[model samples]
Target chain A: MDDLRGGCTLELGSMTSALKAQKILGTAAIPATVVKTSASGGGRGCRYGLRFSCSQMANVRMILANENIRVREAEWKDGS
Target chain B: MEGRELTYLDNAATTFPKPRRVIERMNDLMQNSGGNPGRSSHVLAIKASETVFECREELSDFFGAAGPEQVCFSLNATSSLNFCIKGLLHRGDHVLISDMEHNAVLRPVYRLWRDGVIDYSVFPTFVLEDDGRKTKIIHGILSKLRRNTRMIICSGASNLCSMTMPLAEIGELCRREGILFVVDGAQCAGHIPISLEEMKIDALCIPSHKGLLGPQGCGAAILGKGVMPKTLIEGGNGINSLEADTSGELPERYEAGTLPTPAIAGLCEGVRTVRALGIERIAEHERELFRRALIGLSQIEGVKVYCPHHEGSVLLFNKDGIDSEELCLALSERGICTRGGYHCSALGHKTLGTTNGGALRVSFGVYNSSYDVDKLCEALREI
Candidate 1:
């Protein structure tokens, strides 16, 4: 929670976006679990593979593009 | 659109922005002279037949053939090649072809080879430093001929890199060997001046859509002297429908179907358009475009161009660290249309050392300009 505080937005390109996300999550590998939340407009259910709560992925894309980041998009694996 | 950038460099495959006169003539013929040619003595039928003859005449004069009647209309270059190779060949006959030949010449030869219809060998063009050295290179093909050699098929100019084959010497060799000499003029028919008599070519298969600026589904083969082939396809010749048999003449003997009258009319207009521009001027314009692309691509860092100092039909190259397909996608996104792949000449890729996949090919045409080449180079640099 301390590492995720301050909303310290760094214009990390797609390359650094994944690294930073992994560091903030404190996981060398993404957890293979589904988490449910009640904040979603739709019925939120368990999701996997770094599941976005709402529009975090879209926000990251906008931030990257706005800052002219030259990063390739991260590959997302399917959750069983 | 003037300020906007858009370039199309894939002319060897097919041409766009077709000649206005060709389109007009096609419309005029369809509206005014719509009838089955030679099927009736009615005015419309006679007019349609006349239109067909006029197109044959146009092709005849374009290629310096003996007469207009010698030109046989077909679907395209592939069908024309089939008519020549399959009709004139048999089991155990030997065929001498070129390495730069497109699939039209290759598939039929291969089919024949697999079926034991013929024995074949392909002579690669010798990369010479000087243009004058082409004569000696031609003699090399002649030296490999066996006694039972039935024909020699070579392209007028390579579809890959615009390189003109030494057809005249090959024609002379075939003439001396008592073998048929066929020239696949798919890339050079209307863009370059050709003479059947002067070159002693036995048959020439050409595409009306490429250099001639005609409709896509039309082509012709200018049959040279002593080129009577056995029937590969049998159908109505329109002239002798009641006979229930194919004719044993030149054009009528080979063209067996309801002829493409409208397309032929359009093709005639295409030939007329090319004739008015002058083939020499057309060739020169395309050559200048090639020269610009070669120079520009060579100047770009990490780009390896593939013209090899020869003024050929296609400009092939690849930028370092980029896949050919990826480069093509990038170019297409930039409105710079090009062909990237093996170009249907898989054998050529192995020889050119691009068999891993292939290289990006930018072929030129009379409609293309130096600015197109510049835009392509600029976009490649950006990538």
Candidate 2:
């Protein structure tokens, strides 16, 4: 796996929405992965989030915006 | 009898000899595109997701839904009705349904009533009527409306009698009264034209296998503007994976788990075939067969035909001395397939006053022919 500290995560409302967003991003050629919500992030339990390389964070956001998929929140972890 | 050609007249239960294209499309999906939709970024998965979305769009357009998002897939019309009825009604809410509804609608509402979650009433359906039947039925429904009545659920056509309900008028009544209207289109979706926008229907539950010519295990609920039922099932929708509850979005809010992608592919072709052949033409052909069967059965001695004037492709009747089951079995020995007894619509039998003896139902489809009708009439005459 890539360094966890060098990636960005997007919290979504449900798994279906996340999967739909993932498909749209994949069709647009943006690499993304759906994963469990971070436990310590005050995130809603049993939710999912999409993680991508920190370097492509802006591009991913722009693509999701174009598709009109709402993002509940975004978080970036910094490398030590 | 062993080598005789089979005559299938149980279309109301589920259509047979599905459109050629529907069969081919389902086979193609099973063989070439078996990826789990919306589960990953692989090429097969992406292609599967696209196919599912395209199917949704096709269904939405065919039903005149607000958009593809307004369409949600389910196992069958019963599941769709459960989602709509349970999601929309609350404790103490009053619901109105017609007496002709199948068990799909009746059972769910009854379960809710039994649990004291809600209460419902069955309104009357009109028989062979003169000029004022529509007006009388509408007035009867309006008279029963109470301050607590929140929704009206009805079938587009009677599966037992084959009588087409005045849905557009009923929908108008619901609109003016500000009551939510839902329709069970199990017997009419592919045989009739339904425009959700024009009909002002809040929700429509349909089975793909019966009228849409698709395989079993596929159905859809089309939501109209400003209508949102509570999610029936909560699970992975492949979106908002961080939430503990289901999504509040259009389809994602209702649809859960892995969809039946192969059935949906078949549904797409089914709708396309219906559109290409024209629903009116298919309906007309079935009506012709229904008319011939009705005339022939009515002339037979000791045969009592019900709903003789119903314009749909179904006919219900019984012989004076023969039990409906025995009659059906005799017909079966002659290679004819018909459904006897209550047909899972006990309420419909009650309405038709056939509760005591039940009736044999012979339903037609686009594939049925004059020869099939003639064969059925000949068998009835002999028995």
Candidate 3:
């Protein structure tokens, strides 16, 4: 697993949307990887999100929005 | 007989020997992507969600739904019927149903009528001539239509008798009269080809576990344009969490809580298999089996077979002086499986004139062969 520190993670509502976002971002040449949402980060049940470089974060969000995929939230992890 | 291979003839209840790919896909999903679909974002969750989406797309294409989003998954055909019937009907609304409807459609309507929520009437059973069955049935249905009629709910094919309903004609009638047409496709979805748009069906409820050759615990309802049913269950749809009401999206509005992702995955593969095999080919095979069974059973003395003239793969009959339940037990002892009794379709029994004693139902599927039919006839003869 690549260290996603300093990258922006786009939390999606469902796994289907997350995969769609990943596919769209990949097609757009924006590198992104789907990872499990942290248990404590949300609540119960499995969740997924896409992690991408902070430089392409705005572009990724815009593309997902264009596709009508809902983004639950986005969190930026700070490097320790 | 105890050691002989068991012959399964109760395909109407649920299909056995599901396509190999369906089983494999379900197992793979369970092993690799057993996550709650549509509830979160993660690798496994995304895979699970994609599986569900693929299923919806396959079902939408197969059923001629407007889009994948218009297909909503449920527990079974009964659940889908409940969602459609209970969601769409209001107080004093009139519904027209066929005399051959299974309990899945009849019971819900009866309950609603009992509670003063809706009213419904059963179409009279018309005597079928060689070439006028469809016309007579259509006339019977049209005559029962009242001014307050809001919708028409019927089965694609009768589960008890294998008699297929005239869905296209009924759909046209509903369209011209501005009445909604809802079809319960529990016995016919994968066995017969249906074009939801071409047929003008407003809503179609299907069970994947039956002719679709999928595992149990998963079904779907396809909604046409401008057909919106009230939400049957209110819970988390993973959208609009801040608000109190459920999401108003096509499927999300109807689907609440975690979906059966693994089952949906299996259903996708099942639909794929059906497409590959082609529904026409499957129907031809089952028709042949039904023909053979009818011939074999009709030859036996004291056996009165009902619904022998239908084109579908179901056959209903009873032996003289033999109770249906006792006949079923005898067949079971001889390593044969056949469904006997009311078959959860009291109205169908009445339509077939078998209300005094429920008939024995032998339904053929893709896996059935002439050998199974021969074995069944032999068992019947012995009894």
Fnat, one value per model:
0.00, 0.25, 0.18
DockQ values per model: 0.00, 0.19, 0.19
Predicted model with the maximum DockQ = 2
Which 10 successive residues of model 3 chain A have the least lDDT summed? A38-47
Pitting candidate 1 against candidate 3, the one with the higher lDDT is 3
Greater DockQ among 2 and 3 belongs to 2
* Comparing 1 and 2 on DockQ, the stronger one: 2
lDDT for each candidate structure: 0.72, 0.83, 0.84
Candidate 3: stretches off by over 4 Å? A1-80, B1-4, B125-129
Question: How big is the RMSD of model 2?
Answer: 4.6
Deviation in Å, model 3, residue B129 alpha carbon: 4.2
lDDT of each residue in B1-383, candidate 2, tens digit only: 44236898999999887988999988888899898776665667766766777787888899988767778899999999999999999998999999888999999999999999988998888764535767888988988999989999999988887788788899999999889999999998998899898898999999989888888999999889778888879897655457777754678667779899999899889899889989999999988998898888878999888877777788898899898989999999989999998899978998888998799999998888999999999998888
- lDDT string for model 3 (B1-383, tens) is 43236798888999887888999998988887697777655566656777888888899999998767678899999999999999999888999998888899999999999998888998854523446778887888888889999999989888887678788998999999999999999998998889889999999999889999999999998999779999999998765565677754577768888888888888899899889988999999999998888889889999988867786778888999999989999999988888989999988888778888798988888888999999999989998
* DockQ versus reference, model 3: 0.19
Q: Model 3 Cα RMSD, Å? A: 4.1
The residue-by-residue lDDT of candidate 1 on B241-289, one tens digit each, is 3455675345666776678899999889888888889878887887788
Q: Which ten residues in a row have the lowest lDDT in candidate 1 chain B?
A: B239-248
Candidate 1 lDDT at B166 equals: 78
Error at B367, model 1, angstroms: 1.4
Q: What is the TM-score of each candidate against the true structure?
A: 0.79, 0.85, 0.86
